[model samples]
Target: MEAKKVALVMVDISGYTHFIRAQKVSAIHAEEIVFELLEAVIDRAEYPLTLNKLEGDAVFLYAEIGDNNLARVTRDVAKQVQGFFEAFYDRARTLTEERAECGCDACSRVHDLRLKVLLHSGEAVFRQIRQFEELAGEDVIAIHRLLKNDIPAREYILMTDAFHNLAGNLAGMAYTPSQQTYPDLGTLQIHVFQPSN
Candidate 1:
Protein backbone atom coordinates (compact mmCIF):
# COMPACT_ATOMS: atom_id res chain seq x y z
CA MET A 1 0.00 0.00 0.00
CA GLU A 2 1.20 3.46 -0.88
CA ALA A 3 1.61 5.92 1.98
CA LYS A 4 0.29 9.46 1.62
CA LYS A 5 1.10 12.72 3.38
CA VAL A 6 -1.73 14.18 5.41
CA ALA A 7 -2.34 17.06 7.81
CA LEU A 8 -3.95 16.22 11.11
CA VAL A 9 -5.78 18.80 13.24
CA MET A 10 -7.37 18.38 16.60
CA VAL A 11 -9.44 21.16 18.23
CA ASP A 12 -9.93 20.40 21.90
CA ILE A 13 -11.83 22.14 24.68
CA SER A 14 -9.82 22.73 27.80
CA GLY A 15 -11.23 22.92 31.37
CA TYR A 16 -14.21 20.84 30.33
CA THR A 17 -14.12 18.31 33.13
CA HIS A 18 -12.96 20.77 35.76
CA PHE A 19 -15.71 23.19 34.85
CA ILE A 20 -18.32 20.46 35.15
CA ARG A 21 -17.01 19.14 38.43
CA ALA A 22 -16.30 22.48 40.09
CA GLN A 23 -19.56 24.03 39.04
CA LYS A 24 -21.51 20.87 39.81
CA VAL A 25 -23.30 21.19 36.51
CA SER A 26 -25.74 18.59 35.40
CA ALA A 27 -24.65 15.99 32.90
CA ILE A 28 -27.36 17.04 30.46
CA HIS A 29 -26.43 20.70 30.58
CA ALA A 30 -22.73 19.90 30.28
CA GLU A 31 -23.42 17.69 27.31
CA GLU A 32 -25.48 20.41 25.68
CA ILE A 33 -22.72 23.01 26.03
CA VAL A 34 -20.02 20.64 24.74
CA PHE A 35 -22.12 19.52 21.80
CA GLU A 36 -22.97 23.06 20.86
CA LEU A 37 -19.35 24.18 20.98
CA LEU A 38 -18.11 21.15 19.01
CA GLU A 39 -20.80 21.73 16.41
CA ALA A 40 -19.70 25.35 16.03
CA VAL A 41 -16.15 24.17 15.34
CA ILE A 42 -17.34 21.61 12.79
CA ASP A 43 -19.42 24.22 11.01
CA ARG A 44 -16.30 26.34 10.49
CA ALA A 45 -14.28 23.64 8.71
CA GLU A 46 -13.70 24.25 4.99
CA TYR A 47 -13.02 22.03 2.01
CA PRO A 48 -9.99 19.69 1.76
CA LEU A 49 -10.12 19.38 5.55
CA THR A 50 -12.63 16.66 6.35
CA LEU A 51 -14.03 16.05 9.82
CA ASN A 52 -12.73 12.62 10.80
CA LYS A 53 -14.79 12.21 13.96
CA LEU A 54 -15.88 13.91 17.14
CA GLU A 55 -13.85 12.70 20.12
CA GLY A 56 -15.63 13.78 23.30
CA ASP A 57 -14.70 17.44 23.81
CA ALA A 58 -12.61 17.60 20.65
CA VAL A 59 -12.98 17.39 16.86
CA PHE A 60 -10.50 15.47 14.71
CA LEU A 61 -9.88 16.76 11.17
CA TYR A 62 -7.66 15.43 8.40
CA ALA A 63 -6.81 16.40 4.84
CA GLU A 64 -4.70 14.63 2.26
CA ILE A 65 -1.73 16.66 1.00
CA GLY A 66 -2.43 15.70 -2.60
CA ASP A 67 -1.01 18.24 -5.05
CA ASN A 68 -2.03 21.39 -3.26
CA ASN A 69 0.77 23.84 -2.60
CA LEU A 70 1.91 24.30 0.98
CA ALA A 71 1.06 28.00 1.02
CA ARG A 72 -2.53 27.38 -0.03
CA VAL A 73 -2.97 24.59 2.48
CA THR A 74 -1.50 26.67 5.28
CA ARG A 75 -3.76 29.62 4.53
CA ASP A 76 -6.80 27.34 4.42
CA VAL A 77 -5.96 25.66 7.72
CA ALA A 78 -5.24 28.99 9.37
CA LYS A 79 -8.55 30.36 8.19
CA GLN A 80 -10.41 27.35 9.55
CA VAL A 81 -8.64 27.69 12.89
CA GLN A 82 -9.46 31.38 13.06
CA GLY A 83 -13.05 30.75 12.10
CA PHE A 84 -13.52 28.12 14.79
CA PHE A 85 -12.18 30.39 17.55
CA GLU A 86 -14.26 33.34 16.37
CA ALA A 87 -17.39 31.22 16.35
CA PHE A 88 -16.50 29.64 19.66
CA TYR A 89 -16.00 32.94 21.47
CA ASP A 90 -19.08 34.43 19.85
CA ARG A 91 -21.18 31.48 20.93
CA ALA A 92 -19.80 31.67 24.45
CA ARG A 93 -20.67 35.34 24.69
CA THR A 94 -24.13 34.76 23.32
CA LEU A 95 -24.74 31.97 25.77
CA THR A 96 -23.48 34.11 28.61
CA GLU A 97 -25.86 36.94 27.77
CA GLU A 98 -28.79 34.61 27.17
CA ARG A 99 -28.33 32.99 30.55
CA ALA A 100 -27.31 36.06 32.49
CA GLU A 101 -30.52 35.96 34.45
CA CYS A 102 -30.96 32.18 34.58
CA GLY A 103 -28.44 31.55 37.38
CA CYS A 104 -27.80 27.99 36.21
CA ASP A 105 -24.32 26.63 36.88
CA ALA A 106 -23.62 25.52 33.34
CA CYS A 107 -24.99 28.70 31.83
CA SER A 108 -23.04 30.87 34.23
CA ARG A 109 -19.73 29.19 33.46
CA VAL A 110 -19.86 28.49 29.74
CA HIS A 111 -17.31 31.17 29.07
CA ASP A 112 -14.70 29.36 31.12
CA LEU A 113 -14.13 26.88 28.33
CA ARG A 114 -11.02 27.36 26.22
CA LEU A 115 -9.94 26.11 22.81
CA LYS A 116 -6.60 24.61 21.74
CA VAL A 117 -5.45 22.91 18.55
CA LEU A 118 -2.82 20.28 17.76
CA LEU A 119 -1.44 20.17 14.21
CA HIS A 120 0.88 17.70 12.56
CA SER A 121 1.72 16.78 8.99
CA GLY A 122 3.13 13.36 8.17
CA GLU A 123 2.74 10.14 6.21
CA ALA A 124 -0.16 7.84 6.97
CA VAL A 125 -1.90 4.73 5.70
CA PHE A 126 -5.56 5.31 4.98
CA ARG A 127 -8.12 2.60 5.47
CA GLN A 128 -11.82 2.64 4.80
CA ILE A 129 -13.88 0.58 7.17
CA ARG A 130 -17.60 0.67 6.53
CA GLN A 131 -18.61 4.33 6.46
CA PHE A 132 -15.58 5.72 8.24
CA GLU A 133 -12.17 6.65 6.82
CA GLU A 134 -9.35 6.14 9.30
CA LEU A 135 -5.71 7.27 9.21
CA ALA A 136 -3.22 4.94 10.87
CA GLY A 137 0.54 5.25 11.38
CA GLU A 138 3.16 6.41 13.83
CA ASP A 139 2.36 9.98 12.88
CA VAL A 140 -1.18 9.53 14.09
CA ILE A 141 0.07 8.36 17.45
CA ALA A 142 2.47 11.29 17.66
CA ILE A 143 -0.25 13.86 17.05
CA HIS A 144 -2.45 12.39 19.78
CA ARG A 145 0.49 12.37 22.16
CA LEU A 146 0.77 16.13 21.65
CA LEU A 147 -2.51 16.60 23.46
CA LYS A 148 -0.92 15.67 26.78
CA ASN A 149 1.58 18.51 26.68
CA ASP A 150 2.43 20.93 29.53
CA ILE A 151 1.87 24.19 27.71
CA PRO A 152 1.29 27.10 30.13
CA ALA A 153 -1.32 28.79 28.03
CA ARG A 154 -4.86 27.51 28.05
CA GLU A 155 -5.62 28.60 24.48
CA TYR A 156 -2.95 28.13 21.85
CA ILE A 157 -2.17 26.20 18.66
CA LEU A 158 0.63 23.66 19.06
CA MET A 159 2.13 22.36 15.83
CA THR A 160 4.75 19.71 15.31
CA ASP A 161 8.00 20.93 13.76
CA ALA A 162 7.16 19.01 10.60
CA PHE A 163 3.96 21.01 10.26
CA HIS A 164 5.63 24.34 11.04
CA ASN A 165 8.30 23.65 8.44
CA LEU A 166 5.67 23.23 5.75
CA ALA A 167 3.14 25.82 6.89
CA GLY A 168 5.91 28.41 7.16
CA ASN A 169 5.27 31.63 9.05
CA LEU A 170 1.61 32.29 9.61
CA ALA A 171 0.69 35.96 9.29
CA GLY A 172 0.15 37.86 12.57
CA MET A 173 1.37 34.84 14.54
CA ALA A 174 4.47 34.24 16.62
CA TYR A 175 5.53 30.74 17.67
CA THR A 176 7.55 29.65 20.68
CA PRO A 177 9.63 26.53 20.55
CA SER A 178 8.76 23.86 23.10
CA GLN A 179 9.30 20.20 23.79
CA GLN A 180 7.71 17.44 25.84
CA THR A 181 8.63 13.85 26.55
CA TYR A 182 6.03 11.19 25.95
CA PRO A 183 6.70 7.83 27.55
CA ASP A 184 6.08 5.95 24.34
CA LEU A 185 6.79 8.59 21.70
CA GLY A 186 10.01 9.93 23.26
CA THR A 187 10.88 13.61 23.18
CA LEU A 188 9.42 15.72 20.39
CA GLN A 189 9.97 19.37 19.56
CA ILE A 190 6.91 21.55 18.94
CA HIS A 191 5.96 25.12 18.14
CA VAL A 192 3.23 26.95 20.01
CA PHE A 193 1.28 29.80 18.47
CA GLN A 194 -1.02 31.73 20.75
CA PRO A 195 -3.56 33.83 18.90
CA SER A 196 -4.60 37.10 20.43
CA ASN A 197 -8.28 37.79 20.82
Candidate 2:
Protein backbone atom coordinates (compact mmCIF):
# COMPACT_ATOMS: atom_id res chain seq x y z
CA MET A 1 0.00 0.00 0.00
CA GLU A 2 1.00 3.62 -0.47
CA ALA A 3 2.85 5.36 2.33
CA LYS A 4 0.55 7.06 4.77
CA LYS A 5 0.85 8.82 8.08
CA VAL A 6 0.52 6.43 11.00
CA ALA A 7 0.87 6.58 14.75
CA LEU A 8 3.19 3.88 16.05
CA VAL A 9 3.28 2.57 19.60
CA MET A 10 5.34 0.02 21.49
CA VAL A 11 4.62 -1.21 25.01
CA ASP A 12 7.74 -2.84 26.39
CA ILE A 13 8.37 -4.63 29.65
CA SER A 14 11.25 -3.10 31.53
CA GLY A 15 13.90 -5.28 33.24
CA TYR A 16 12.69 -8.18 31.14
CA THR A 17 16.14 -9.57 30.27
CA HIS A 18 17.24 -9.41 33.88
CA PHE A 19 14.06 -11.05 35.09
CA ILE A 20 14.38 -13.93 32.63
CA ARG A 21 18.07 -14.43 33.40
CA ALA A 22 17.54 -14.24 37.12
CA GLN A 23 14.74 -16.78 37.02
CA LYS A 24 16.18 -19.42 34.70
CA VAL A 25 15.13 -22.21 37.06
CA SER A 26 11.60 -20.89 36.90
CA ALA A 27 11.74 -19.95 33.24
CA ILE A 28 8.44 -21.56 32.39
CA HIS A 29 6.59 -19.52 35.00
CA ALA A 30 8.47 -16.40 34.01
CA GLU A 31 7.50 -16.82 30.38
CA GLU A 32 3.93 -17.50 31.38
CA ILE A 33 3.82 -14.35 33.50
CA VAL A 34 5.19 -12.30 30.65
CA PHE A 35 2.58 -13.74 28.32
CA GLU A 36 -0.19 -12.77 30.75
CA LEU A 37 1.10 -9.22 31.04
CA LEU A 38 1.25 -8.92 27.26
CA GLU A 39 -2.29 -10.21 27.00
CA ALA A 40 -3.49 -7.57 29.44
CA VAL A 41 -1.96 -4.83 27.34
CA ILE A 42 -3.35 -6.33 24.16
CA ASP A 43 -6.81 -6.55 25.68
CA ARG A 44 -6.72 -2.83 26.36
CA ALA A 45 -6.06 -1.95 22.72
CA GLU A 46 -9.17 -0.62 21.03
CA TYR A 47 -10.08 0.10 17.43
CA PRO A 48 -7.76 2.09 15.15
CA LEU A 49 -4.80 0.84 17.22
CA THR A 50 -3.96 -2.46 15.53
CA LEU A 51 -1.46 -4.96 16.89
CA ASN A 52 1.38 -5.15 14.40
CA LYS A 53 3.25 -7.90 16.21
CA LEU A 54 4.54 -9.13 19.54
CA GLU A 55 8.26 -8.32 19.85
CA GLY A 56 9.23 -10.73 22.60
CA ASP A 57 9.03 -8.24 25.52
CA ALA A 58 7.17 -5.53 23.63
CA VAL A 59 3.95 -5.05 21.68
CA PHE A 60 4.28 -3.14 18.41
CA LEU A 61 1.11 -1.37 17.33
CA TYR A 62 0.05 1.13 14.68
CA ALA A 63 -2.96 3.22 13.62
CA GLU A 64 -3.41 4.76 10.22
CA ILE A 65 -4.21 8.48 10.12
CA GLY A 66 -6.94 9.57 7.74
CA ASP A 67 -7.49 13.12 6.58
CA ASN A 68 -10.81 13.38 8.38
CA ASN A 69 -9.95 11.35 11.51
CA LEU A 70 -6.70 12.80 12.71
CA ALA A 71 -8.12 14.24 15.92
CA ARG A 72 -10.15 11.18 16.80
CA VAL A 73 -7.33 8.75 16.04
CA THR A 74 -4.82 10.70 18.11
CA ARG A 75 -7.15 10.79 21.09
CA ASP A 76 -7.80 7.08 20.82
CA VAL A 77 -4.12 6.17 20.52
CA ALA A 78 -3.20 8.45 23.42
CA LYS A 79 -5.89 6.98 25.64
CA GLN A 80 -4.86 3.45 24.70
CA VAL A 81 -1.22 4.16 25.50
CA GLN A 82 -2.18 5.50 28.91
CA GLY A 83 -4.45 2.54 29.60
CA PHE A 84 -1.65 0.06 28.86
CA PHE A 85 0.09 0.96 32.10
CA GLU A 86 -2.96 0.24 34.20
CA ALA A 87 -3.72 -3.00 32.37
CA PHE A 88 -0.16 -4.31 32.70
CA TYR A 89 0.26 -3.36 36.34
CA ASP A 90 -3.17 -4.63 37.36
CA ARG A 91 -2.36 -8.05 35.90
CA ALA A 92 1.05 -7.97 37.53
CA ARG A 93 -0.53 -7.18 40.89
CA THR A 94 -3.03 -10.00 40.52
CA LEU A 95 -0.30 -12.46 39.56
CA THR A 96 1.78 -11.38 42.54
CA GLU A 97 -1.14 -11.93 44.93
CA GLU A 98 -2.13 -15.22 43.35
CA ARG A 99 1.41 -16.57 43.50
CA ALA A 100 2.37 -15.01 46.82
CA GLU A 101 2.90 -18.36 48.47
CA CYS A 102 5.18 -19.56 45.67
CA GLY A 103 8.86 -18.99 46.41
CA CYS A 104 9.89 -19.01 42.74
CA ASP A 105 11.99 -16.02 41.74
CA ALA A 106 9.53 -15.13 38.98
CA CYS A 107 6.62 -15.01 41.43
CA SER A 108 8.46 -13.19 44.20
CA ARG A 109 9.85 -10.50 41.92
CA VAL A 110 6.90 -9.74 39.64
CA HIS A 111 6.88 -6.22 41.00
CA ASP A 112 10.15 -5.49 39.23
CA LEU A 113 8.46 -5.77 35.84
CA ARG A 114 7.46 -2.33 34.60
CA LEU A 115 5.88 -1.15 31.35
CA LYS A 116 7.25 1.61 29.14
CA VAL A 117 5.52 2.98 26.04
CA LEU A 118 6.96 4.73 23.01
CA LEU A 119 4.92 6.80 20.56
CA HIS A 120 5.79 8.26 17.17
CA SER A 121 3.88 9.62 14.17
CA GLY A 122 5.18 9.33 10.63
CA GLU A 123 4.71 7.82 7.19
CA ALA A 124 4.76 4.08 6.53
CA VAL A 125 4.07 1.60 3.78
CA PHE A 126 2.05 -1.45 4.69
CA ARG A 127 2.43 -4.87 3.07
CA GLN A 128 0.89 -8.28 3.67
CA ILE A 129 3.18 -11.25 3.46
CA ARG A 130 0.86 -14.28 3.57
CA GLN A 131 -0.49 -14.25 7.14
CA PHE A 132 1.70 -11.42 8.39
CA GLU A 133 1.19 -7.68 7.87
CA GLU A 134 4.32 -5.56 8.06
CA LEU A 135 4.91 -1.82 8.40
CA ALA A 136 8.04 -0.47 6.76
CA GLY A 137 9.45 3.08 6.81
CA GLU A 138 11.89 5.38 8.51
CA ASP A 139 9.31 6.08 11.19
CA VAL A 140 9.02 2.39 11.98
CA ILE A 141 12.77 2.18 12.42
CA ALA A 142 12.79 5.35 14.52
CA ILE A 143 10.09 4.07 16.85
CA HIS A 144 11.86 0.75 17.39
CA ARG A 145 15.16 2.54 17.94
CA LEU A 146 13.47 4.61 20.66
CA LEU A 147 13.21 1.49 22.81
CA LYS A 148 16.91 1.87 23.68
CA ASN A 149 16.82 5.33 25.23
CA ASP A 150 18.42 6.53 28.44
CA ILE A 151 15.22 7.34 30.28
CA PRO A 152 16.03 6.88 33.98
CA ALA A 153 12.57 5.67 34.85
CA ARG A 154 11.29 2.11 35.03
CA GLU A 155 7.88 3.05 33.65
CA TYR A 156 7.04 6.06 31.49
CA ILE A 157 5.53 7.25 28.17
CA LEU A 158 7.83 8.72 25.55
CA MET A 159 6.42 10.46 22.48
CA THR A 160 8.10 12.11 19.55
CA ASP A 161 7.43 15.77 18.77
CA ALA A 162 5.53 14.76 15.65
CA PHE A 163 3.09 12.77 17.77
CA HIS A 164 2.87 15.52 20.39
CA ASN A 165 1.76 17.95 17.72
CA LEU A 166 -0.93 15.53 16.61
CA ALA A 167 -2.18 14.50 20.06
CA GLY A 168 -1.73 17.85 21.83
CA ASN A 169 -1.04 17.73 25.62
CA LEU A 170 -2.44 14.22 26.14
CA ALA A 171 -5.28 15.20 28.49
CA GLY A 172 -3.67 15.43 31.96
CA MET A 173 -0.01 14.72 31.24
CA ALA A 174 2.72 17.31 31.76
CA TYR A 175 5.63 16.16 29.61
CA THR A 176 9.28 16.82 30.29
CA PRO A 177 11.14 17.76 27.13
CA SER A 178 14.17 15.61 26.32
CA GLN A 179 16.41 14.74 23.39
CA GLN A 180 18.13 11.55 22.24
CA THR A 181 20.90 11.27 19.67
CA TYR A 182 21.75 8.14 17.76
CA PRO A 183 24.85 7.86 15.61
CA ASP A 184 22.74 6.99 12.58
CA LEU A 185 19.27 8.47 13.30
CA GLY A 186 20.70 11.76 14.52
CA THR A 187 18.75 13.77 17.11
CA LEU A 188 15.18 13.13 18.24
CA GLN A 189 13.31 15.60 20.43
CA ILE A 190 10.87 13.86 22.75
CA HIS A 191 8.42 14.43 25.57
CA VAL A 192 8.47 12.08 28.54
CA PHE A 193 5.60 11.44 30.94
CA GLN A 194 6.12 9.34 34.03
CA PRO A 195 2.71 8.34 35.37
CA SER A 196 2.03 8.17 39.08
CA ASN A 197 0.94 4.99 40.82
| Residue 110, candidate 1: C-alpha displacement in angstroms | 0.8
lDDT per residue, candidate 1, 2-47, as tens digits? 5788888999999988877866646677778888888888888888
The residue pairs in collision within model 2 are none
lDDT (C-alpha, whole model) for all candidates: 0.83, 0.91
Lowest lDDT block of 10, candidate 2: 166-175
Error (Å) of candidate 2 at residue 14 is 0.5
Instruction: Give the per-residue lDDT digits (tens) of candidate 2, residues 1-197.
Output: 67888999989999999999999899999999999999999999988999999999999999999888876797789888888888998999999999999999999999999999999998899988999999998999999999999989888899899888888776677679999998889999999987866
Runs in model 2 lying further than 4 Å from the true structure = none
Write down the TM-score of every candidate: 0.92, 0.96
Please report the candidate that would top lDDT against the real structure.
2
Relative to the unseen true structure, what is the Cα RMSD of model 1?
1.8
